[model samples]
Target: MESEKYNADLSRFHGMIENLPCGFFIAQAQKPYRLLYANDEMLRLFDCRDLRDFCRYIEQDVRNIVAVNDRERVEREIGHDLQAKSDRFEHVRSHLFTRESRIRYADISGRLVGTEEFGPVFYCTLQEIDIPQPGQMVDRDIRDYVVGHLDEAIANQWIQVYYQPVIRTLTGELCGMEALARWVDPHVGFLSPAAFIPVLEQVRLIYRLDSFVLEEACRIMRQRMDEGLPITPVSVNLSRYDFDLMDVCQVLEQTRQKYSLPRDFLHVEITESALAQDSAVMHQTIDRLREEGYEVWLDDFGSGYSSLNILKDYNIDLIKLDMGFLRTFTDASRSIVTAVITMAKELGIKTLAEGVETKEHADFLASIGCGRQQGYFYGKPQPIGGTLAHIESEGRGIEPRKWCHYYDVASMFIRQTDRACALFDRYGDGHVHCLYANKTYGEQVHELGYQLQDIEEDLGRPETAEVVRTFWAYVDRSRKSGQMETYFYIDGGDYVNTALQVVCEMNQHLLIYVEIQNLSQSNAGRRQSKLDENLRYLYTMFEDVYLVHI
Candidate 1:
């Protein structure tokens, strides 16, 4: 009698489930996922003719219900959700495959239940959903699509890495490249970063995208090297979420090592706003990247409120001036940019101006001493192949000569000092080139009754020939002895105290730092004191200062 009552109660329960409005089913938890039961609504949802057809359509396996493209992700997500909750229930959104080979977006909710017949099974309910049209898609729609299709997009080459050339301002040579991501989605057409990046961040999937970009950049670099093409450092942008989601430094190091590329070949760029969040992770990431020989550039600088604060707190190698300054080119804007470049130079941080569309903008930036530039005026972002072809045609793909570093180092020192300082380069032609002169150096030249232009135009002029020879002699002595040398000479009856130090020497190329002190009416004691002070300062800066008695 008790058995009959139990059977009657079970039948009633099944009948009620079969009439439920939504689809309901039960399947084994383990692989091969044999379906134990499916209600009438469930059969209809899959467009099956009957129970037999439903069984055949899904191969009697619950896993087959999900579209093959989405099966792995759905399973992984469901597993994660179930493991994270003590209730053993999970809710996921995925694509389902119907009997007619149609794809349906679905909302699935399931619970893990144990039964005597099946060790463990999922009692699930699924509801078909309508995806909004691209024109009407909201954030949620975009989010779902991105999350579902990101892997596919990466696998299918829908995501392409574009390179924008970074040019050295002084020489207009290609100094580096910035790797930017451009997505050409097959389903929705071209998706700008504005369309998908924020969605990815909100869904915590940005790290995957960033990692993909890093890998692509490394591959391009390796390919370029293999082809015997000149390559400059390629910078990959990292979102703030990257630090929170994964070990950013480890990923970068691994990617670089995987290609056997030098650390300098790949650079890292983080937005100014990202750094403004100011977390310990961000600080550590910057420090570690720099320590590992990678240059860390602060991208989109001045876009955020804490630009100066970030500069003070973080050790950034370069600052990419925001494009907004160029968009609204005005006297006020120019002044602001000039101040920023000057400040950055003084802080020993290099500056690059972006959005340079006109020659006027480029010329202004170069005049203000911005070290690098990137804009349509130079070259728009292009795919690796396009970039290579453009570079080849323009004949600007060659790497900067090793002697450039000498000028860079000397410029850094000269910019930091208020005293008159200049960089002099002498090649095999024996012509001394005043490669750079700071404002103070130019002013000092004027005070000595010689035009700065004249000196720079012809350092070999008869008027300055004697002094130039003396300066070269000191430079040679400093080079041969590997020590700093000083000389005092009279030019136009003015007592000029000078210090000549060889900054760098490569074969016939010699880079010298010239510090000029005009002690025209000063006494012997004053001249000696000034020279001592200059030597002390040089020693403090470079730790290699020696006074040689002639």
Candidate 2:
């Protein structure tokens, strides 16, 4: 009796769906998605004569009904929505292929359902909308054109790669460049990246575009090398689809190797939004990229609410400050940018400011110790051919400094402190050059009855000779052990404590950070008395007391 009622209920459900005005169908939940049933409206929407014709046109698979360009995105979105939401219903918009191979814009809604015969399936509704084209091309038209002509665009060189310079704030030299894609169609003239990039992303064809840009950038780098022109790292942006669709790290590595370029020559930039999607995969990809010697930068950082979370979860080499921070250019924005740069420095990550269009913006970013800057203030994005011509006319090209990274890192460290701190480059010849010193360092030197200029310029003064020698000795030990600290007496019976830390060593020169603290005057008398007592006790304890002098 129950079996008969189940059959009757199924029959009633089929009848109700067949009479509905809109298109309705049932499909398997899994891949190859066998189409179990389709209403007459669904057959008409697909331009099919009947149910058998519809099934045959779609190859008995619901997935076949979606246009090739939109299939992956539609499937991914539906699957993700089904897993993430408690509600059984999910909606997605995609372009579907009709029986006559015509593209139709569709709004699809599906609800998960269980049946005795099909086990688990999706009961889906499809609606087709005819979008009108205006004098200017609408988004639907652009998407259609891109979907059909993207491959042709790439092949015919309609897709062009352009580069914008990234300058080191301190040196005002080109430290890097960011590769950007531009579309120039013969039929449509020039198309804004805003118009095409998002469309490509929606259709999940962004990985191909990004790969094209990277390949073009590599070719440019090789050309520059062949011409003996100066070359710096060129950063290439990667879309999230790149990671989802292919082995992103493998692609990058293969491209770098193909051009015989250094791993650092091509930097990987992933936007914050991209990183937030499928963080597990992103984390693994980032790790693999870095492990292969590619510097992975978080592009458009601070553009989203999960910025801090991304920093916490992934190991990033640098962060590109979102241009939104500088768009309005308010005091509040300044404070926020400053705080972000400081925080990144403290976390041992570099920062680059974007949209630095004005002198005020550039000056402010430099004042705040932003490591890098990229904007129209430096140069606009241009093709490689144009860039080389401009450089030739200007008689110089952007060159990378080997020690700039170390210098910038040390400068940021010294600037953030209120203590007497300075950065020094120690040479093998027992001489040191001051790279940078904080205001507190100069004030402390003045308080010690010494001129800051004299201390930095010449340590050969009678009063400073011994101190300099001792400091160099500490520097040497720090180079071997990473850090060293000592307390010593200065000329005015003032005790001072000093620390030496090695930041990096390159070309036989060590970058060291030094901090000095002047002890309180009130403790001098007590310290002197204690020192005399200890000296006397040591002399008495040891029959032969040897003193080592510097």
Candidate 3:
């Protein structure tokens, strides 16, 4: 009776901590140390697979997630300042992961809250802070500085164009370029689109800005054509908030006649969010653009709820995959990517990748049936003057690039990711979430990466956030259990193929051990084909869906 009672109490004590609501942590004032103890909520925050994998993660999160320059300064302080300061408290505010891919602010405060009874220990809590609009880049005078010089700046042509070149992968030819709008107010020179776009959107003046850019682009394209220069289509992106004010087809039609250029010379890029909400209006608008003999490119593909049905439903001419997809490699991502490409091929749609940084990344995109890529690797977004200078200086043909092979990517996917791979900070607080995914069966814990929610939304799969305090009820019964693969119906009839493997991570967060089974398909036909079909289906849903060998 006594032995049984003792075991019950011990189990109950751990049970309480294991089921804690908040992300709880206990640590000593050690350097890059191990987690002494981490609660269940803490595990979800880090998306850590298990405690033993602590070496793979870090505490300060001073990696790229903290931004480039800020990390260096923080590290310098932690090294130089912490050495002299003893028993002193300090509050360090930095951006940390918020179980979502977005980097939200974290107020990490530390103090020596230890008594002789409690022993020598430091107590700290990392509370996530709400991020305000404009993303804190502007602290003083957001509008006054710009509004003060509205006319002089406009007249002086301070509003300039930065062309992000979009390249064709297969032929290594220049397909086109996307026109990114930039402004340099005399008072507040070199302002980000974020700072001013909100102002434009809020004040309902974005259409005016868009019109100026379109007219300017048409003039430039006509001039380039007249000069007998190599000019392909130039895409000008429009925001949904204001893009609807003007008939895109009508605008292009008029511009075509005025410039004596064909409709094929200009393209209109629309965002996924705008497209998803007003799809009916978009269908009519897009059809008009297509009917006018112009191309319609889906900008920021795979940025939001990119679903297979969403792909099948729309007939977009081009796919511009978001840059976030390249942040890391995972098996699921690899499969999804391959599927996206295959689906695009089946529909005869062109695809382009944004933010290609390295030769390896460029090569990977080309390998996965993506023939076009845009980013710093090919060339940075620059002014027309800069672009002409680069073309003239660098010579006017396709630049030769070597294909970089990746071993970290999953090799199982039928269509492989044929690009270079970059290291990502897989360990972050934002990747953590408690998904109460208890089916008719028992429940278990899972911590996914930051972008996994986007993945969930894209695949129309189960939200892996484990916080409803629902999955824990089964832990008491299933802790010492058999690991097995399971399938759950996600979003209507959508099926998420999950296998119970082992996730290895630092006590930083929980590791997710899932093996490749299949996706979306309801266990039909050959396994590989099912994998391929499901992947293709997912890609169709999410335009920029990519396959990594991750």
Candidate 4:
């Protein structure tokens, strides 16, 4: 009873630490700075997976996460604090890497805390300093400073463009990049976008900034091409105000023509929220742009007001799923994502999932069929010079992890099945969450990815809902009976003959396997001709959805 009580107390202690808002860490007061303990937020902030992973990484060196130049200074200061047994250390600006290996800046504070048993330890809290502090208003002086330097900065090359790479999910090939804006003020050092962009936008000077980025991005790509380097398409984001201020197409077309670049070389990305303004003009602009051989992507999708109506009406070439969409792993979120991918596939749209940090996120996305992705897993944004240097240097071998524990069954089957197949975990509801998918099914479903639970999405459409319902019912019954079931459904006039099998793994967990094949064109055509008659035949053919008892 005493031991049980102690264990319960310890569990509560862990819970409290995990719930802390700010990142907290405890490190030994010695060389190599061995990590003793860290809160969940600390792991999250440093982009460490867990305590075991974090300990494995440092191998007794705090410099593993610190910036190269800052390492010596950081170590010296910490050593001083430890030697003197300082009660507390004031805020110190520090550079660190997120679990995704993205570079970030933070204001760190450390306090020397210890007991006889531990000897000495440093407790630290990290507060990221790059973002604006809550309730801290932007000062007028900074605004005026920006306004005063705007013209000179433009002419003297203070504004810079950085390229963040986007890779093909399956092959890890460098497929494209996004052009981001940066400002380097000689007096103030590197000014973040959060600092200068609002000032620019307030003065309606954002167009000038966007134009510079577009031109410079094109020039950089052109230079790389001239150097005999293969260059992929680069996307430049345009503000809603940018579209209103100038002929966006004209600006892009002129830049392309001046560089003699191919039409597909440059891409445009517009935010989903921006779609609400001046719909008619925006529609016409997008239509004209597409006709002129340019691709327009919907940026930051599923962040705000993600209306299916916008997707249905717009002529968008691609949709970039926002990181927030996958921030929380839940059944509902998965279901929604599944539906979104399903609809996007039917509409012939491509998807690129952003903010993919972990191998789990990447594998899940690839299994769903969304193979175009970008995130810290690939690499962080770098200046044009850095990007070029990186390209010239050795390849960073950033590839999607081929296997995952959660989706082990699906991963195993994908390697062997030529036919499209998906592995699902029965959730004991009318729903089953897809765990893995074969490449054939994954790629065929959509260029981006689809969710397995998206089977529920078909229930909404009166056209395909009934057929899907029958299919699920068959699956559900067969799973319960510990057996196999076969069913069929029509996808875009193609008859997908499907077979479902259930297996009990060593863990005593049940896995449902879905195998699918697209019937030959002749067979599909013949089925299409007898669609009405076949609909009647489908119900009777199932014969009350009988299961083949294994």
Q: Pick the candidate with the highest TM-score.
A: 2
Residue runs of model 2 more than 4 Å from their true location after superposition:
1-140, 326-332, 385-405, 408-415, 427-432, 442-453, 459-464, 488-497, 517-550
Worst 10 residues of 3 by lDDT: 403-412
All candidates in order of lDDT, best leading = 1, 2, 4, 3
Q: For candidate 2, lDDT tens digit of each residue in 1-550? A: 2222332354624333546667777777867678777777888768788777777787777888877766755664565456545435455766665676554566788878776676677878887655324333334466788888999999999999998878776556577889999776765545557657998999999999999999989988888789887788899999888888889988888888888998878789999998887468888989988998889999989888899988998999999996567667898888898889999988989888886666778877766678889876566578866765654564544655566556566546644456788777766664667766767878777888887667755543324576676766776687777755554544464556677788888767777877877763435545677764565577568755444549
lDDT tens string, model 4, 330-358?
A: 77776676566656766767778887766
Residue-wise C-alpha lDDT for candidate 1, range 1-550, written one tens digit per residue:
2222332344423323545677777778898788777777777767787777888887778888887756755765575457556436555666665676444567788878766755777878887666436454233355677788999999999998999888876556787889999876655544557557988999899999999999999998898789987778898999999999999999999999999998878878999989999999999989999998888999989987999999999999989996578657889898899888889877888788887766788777765677778876676678977876776677774445464465455445444356688777777666667767777778878888887667755655434576666666787799888777777765665567788788787767777878887875445636577664665567458834444666
- Give the whole-model CA lDDT for all candidates, comma-separated: 0.75, 0.74, 0.53, 0.66
Candidate 3: tens digits of C-alpha lDDT, residues 1-550: 2222322343422223344344555454554432344444544545455443321444432142243334643333343334335654444545433323333444454444443432444444555444345533322555554555544555688888778776666445455777877775433334556556667777666776777778888888889779876666788877776546767667767867998987767888888877777457777877777877777888888878754555677778877776556557566765676677777766767777786766667766755656568876566567876765665564555332221111112111113422111111122443433221112111111222224345334323224443212222222223335343333323333434443422233334333333322233323524456665686578569855544543
Clash counts for all predictions: 0, 0, 44, 7
Against the true structure, candidate 2 reaches a TM-score of 0.63
Q: Write down the TM-score for model 1.
A: 0.61
TM-score of 4: 0.54
RMSD, each candidate, Å? 21.0, 17.2, 23.5, 17.3
| TM-score for each model | 0.61, 0.63, 0.49, 0.54
Cα-based lDDT at residue 155, candidate 2: 98
The weakest ten consecutive residues by lDDT in model 2 span: 1-10
Which number leads on lDDT? 1
| N/CA/C clash count, model 1 | 0
